[model samples]
Target: MKRLGVLLISLSVIACQSEKKTTGQTDSTNAGTTSSSLTYKYDSLQVFSKTTTAIDKGKADTAYAKIVYPIFSNEQLNQLVEKKAIDAAGDVDSEKPKTYKEMAASFVEGFDSVNGEPDMGQPGAWFLDDQTKVLVSQPDYLCLEHSNVSYAGGAHPNSAMVFWNFDPKTLKEITLESLIKEGGLPELNAIAEKIFRKNEKLSPTASLKDSYFFEKDTFSLNRNFTITKEGLKFLYNPYEIKAYAYGSTELLIPFSELKALAKPNTLLSPTP
Candidate 1:
């Protein structure tokens, strides 16, 4: 588990660079021109990342937790940098952007709340571990994956995944509706369901009840997905489409598969 944590932290700082650059003169007359002439190309992001940890120790009990997440730092490309930095720097705004440290603290607080107080009589330690990384950070898109594993005197440690995609230019989260063209959901859903069934190793005629997926026997695609130069990848976290024992599932729908369905000039379309 420690190795897993180290790998995730190391991944955050790799291959990060600014897309837009200074391209004009320095004179006052050219100052306005400089601001107006700077062009933003679709490529990659300049990222700032930090890891925060918390440890609570008592006479007979102790708890530890940590979190790692990245921040997009291009002013024109991402508007959340300043606010997120402020929150990370110890600002007390409840509505302000949250830092990785804050995320870890919240997890610790929740564990304490649910368990009431640690048992002073127990001689062992309680622990919480969380790690997140940039799965893809490109000029037009960004994908992040978060893994949180924790235990507070439970039968076993539990882990889950959180996936996020955003439009780098506007710094807003992306969704299925934004990527697919009008009337494309039906086609997309049909394709995704077929892939889902195949991944589950069920025959074409097999029913959802044949497996541990949604007790309701419903077949639907998860809204969590990421875009890459090659294709669109949809992810399903534990207990999302199947029992936790079955673990996570990932499906890749290549650009060719969605070529006619995805809206042009969006993340889903093939990059030129």
Candidate 2:
């Protein structure tokens, strides 16, 4: 359990670079640039790359990919840096009320919402308090996270956030299941509508997804990945992988491609 929290906070944010020296070769598979010597390409993934029969028959991969692709491919770090968004993502102790450590602790507390319960059996369940942790919209983003936290339990192809990252400080395990998309306010419907329309379905998995509007305007791209039966390995691992963002229309990114997007100054965690 201790190691699990580490997994969730695994991606540690790095210090900002004082001077921006544009170097290194951006990969062609990366969908970000069109003018570079190495251009990336993406054949629009049909709603049913795996299925030829039903629209809803396919996993939420395309819906997930649609948003994720642009985030990774089109993110202009320079723009973000110029606007000082990157520094804000990890605003550190400079924030108003709580310190970074305190804020992180508060997040854990809200996650479990029942951290006091120690004897709970594996203490796991989807969308249920005993089993999920969430990644809510950031300070300036309208994102939210929720999950069943059990790809093992889904046993099905479709799975959202269902992973764990052990946090030793709390001495409790945190699973990726609580971050939901429930409407924060009526206005949030606009965000949900986009997700719904783009998804071409309503309530795809019943997990509560929150408004990511703040993220949409704040970032150029968003990325997320989930490990299901879709060819990646997860069993006996006690962890899962996923990324998400809310930004520009064309900046959606996939998990497979996101690994390449990691910048030197980007937050990274100790690989579990």
Among the numbered candidates, top lDDT falls to 1
Tens digit per residue, CA lDDT, model 2, 1-272: 22334323421321111111113344554333322221222222111011111224452211111111112232342232112221222323333212222222322322233332444223223121111212221222111122221111223222333232222222132222221222322332334344444553434444333433333332111123222222111221111211233211222222343233222221221123
**Segments of candidate 1 deviating more than 4 angstroms:** 1-61, 74-99, 109-124, 270-272
Q: Which portions of model 2 miss their true places by more than 4 Å? A: 1-22, 34-77, 81-84, 94-272
| Lowest lDDT block of 10, candidate 2 | 61-70
Candidate 2: lDDT over CA atoms? Answer: 0.25
Candidate 1 per-residue C-alpha lDDT over 19-71 given as tens digits, one digit per residue, 9 for 90 to 100: 12233323432222112222322221222222222334634444455543343
Clashing pairs in 1: 43-139
For model 1 the local lDDT of residue 55 reads: 36
Q: After superposition, how far is residue 260 of candidate 1 from its true place, in Å?
A: 1.7
